[model samples]
Target chain A: EAEVAQSPRYKITEKSQAVAFWCDPISGHATLYWYRQILGQGPELLVQFQDESVVDDSQLPKDRFSAERLKGVDSTLKIQPAELGDSAMYLCASSSRLSYNEQFFGPGTRLTVL
Target chain B: SQQGEEDPQALSIQEGENATMNCSYKTSINNLQWYRQNSGRGLVHLILIRSNEREKHSGRLRVTLDTSKKSSSLLITASRAADTASYFCATVSDRGSTLGRLYFGRGTQLTVWP
Candidate 1:
């Protein structure tokens, strides 16, 4: 079975530093999602993309967080001046359609900010 | 303000026993989904119950949805040690600007001891 791919399975960084995570969705998936999961809490959506255009990013902290899916196949999420509260598991998911029918998630990139 | 909230934050069961988790949501949803996550890993999709559907089953997992009550339940029958994980309930609203967006709950931690 094809799976979503994520890089930097673990990231440790100091507060106020910049960090980025990468994700590659399944080959034919057209919708990609970025989520942040805090300890003991379910994941929250940070951004959603349809092809190369962003469909929703209402919860994303626009001032510090940014995500882009340039070619629509892979995506990158960057945080400038990371904060201690930003430490969490970054998850990426993909689906054949834009709906939340059945999403396939990656192994995730665990970010720890000190 | 969370759309979905799961009950019994933690549960413990012996191998070969059954486990049940309940989820309640605050809004009308188009579909509800159940996901499982192992420690320090990403989530895996389990079962999805549509708003119009009352019950769904996949292998040993059974999911039931009550749109009138806005609640859902997941039952894992004849569970094994490998079934131990955090289970989350996610919903996609039928009415919203981000129609396809998913709202996830805090999840229930289940431990199945062999």
Candidate 2:
């Protein structure tokens, strides 16, 4: 089975710095999602993309965070001037359609803002 | 808050025993899904149950949804050491949104001893 792919399994950066995470959804998957998971808590949606357009980014912090899927195949999420609370597991997931569906996930990128 | 809540934050059992985790959500949902994550890794899709469905089974995993109660349960039977992981319940709401999203619960951590 084809799975989503993410880069930089682990990242350690100091506060006030910049960092980015990347994700490539499964082939032919129409929907892609980015989530943030804090320790001992459930994952939280950061953004959602359909094809090459962003469908939802209500949860994304516009002041310091931005995400784009220009071609709709791969995406990049960036955070500038990171804060201590920004340390968490960044996850990428993909699904076939908008209807009731199961999502495929990647290994994730662990971001630690020191 | 669109987040869901999961019961039994933690559980421990011997190998071959059955583990059960329950999830409750506040809003109407199109479907409910179960996922597993090992430590800091990304989520792994387990099973999905549609709102119209009562129960569904896959291998040793069984999922049941009660729309009336706004609750769902996941059962892992004949568990093994590899089954020791954090289980989360996610829901896709019936309402329309900018982008389709899945809201996850806090999750239940299960430890299966051999």
Candidate 3:
């Protein structure tokens, strides 16, 4: 069904370690989004990309988190020196510019920091 | 900070019963979208209602938006066990520079017992 693809459905790491999650959006989608969902809470936007360019990242914690969509098709989100509070489900979503109303989400990478 | 908040954090109902969830947002939005996520799974887009549109329906799902009150509601008629999931409301703000960025609510967890 042309779903967004995410790798390493689950990840566990030490608090001070580094971790990365990858996502490949649906083909021809121009807008990509990264969101973080804490247990019992709604997902929050971490970053947004438009054709390889960042459109919004105000909510992203730049001191420890970084995200990139170099080709505008696939994206990578990284957290260096991860914290225990960072444990959550990292989600990726994409939508076509023509029909920006609906977003297709990936299975997500559940990150657990010890 | 999340832009929307959903009512009734959790709901339990029998199969074939109708389920309703409500959402309220803090700002003017271009559109409001509803999504469902099963346990440990990705989100599935259900329906989207534009700010100008008051109501929309898809199969057993119906959504209504009240722009004046900055609120929306989702009603699922003839619910089944398979309909058990967490439902979330996402809004695209009209004041944002990007048109596709979504701000989500905490979500409503629904359980449909057979």
Which CAPRI quality tier does the interface of model 3 achieve?
high
Q: Taking the candidates in order, what DockQ does each have?
A: 0.82, 0.73, 0.89
lDDT of 3 at B75: 100
Question: What local lDDT does model 3 show for residue B20?
Answer: 99
State the displacement of the C-alpha of residue A61, model 1, in Å, after optimal TM-score superposition: 0.6
- Indicate the docking level reached by candidate 1: high
Across B1-114, the per-residue lDDT of candidate 2 in tens digits comes to 666799999999999999999999999998888999998898998998989999999999999999999999999999999999999998888888543578999999999999
TM-scores of all candidate predictions against the true structure: 0.97, 0.96, 0.97
- lDDT by residue (A46-65, candidate 1, tens digit) is 99999999999989999999
DockQ-derived CAPRI band for the predicted complex in model 2 = medium
TM-score pick, better of 1 and 2: 1
Second chain of candidate 1: TM-score? 0.96
- Compared with the true structure, all predictions reach lDDT values of 0.93, 0.91, 0.93
Report the C-alpha lDDT of model 2 over A61-94, residue by residue, as the tens digit.
9999999999889999999989999999999999
When sorted by TM-score, best at the front, the candidate numbers are 3, 1, 2
List, residue by residue over B39-109, the lDDT tens digit for candidate 1: 99999989888899999999999999988988999999999999999999999888865646778999999
Candidate order by lDDT, decreasing, is 3, 1, 2
Off by over 4 Å in 2: A98-100
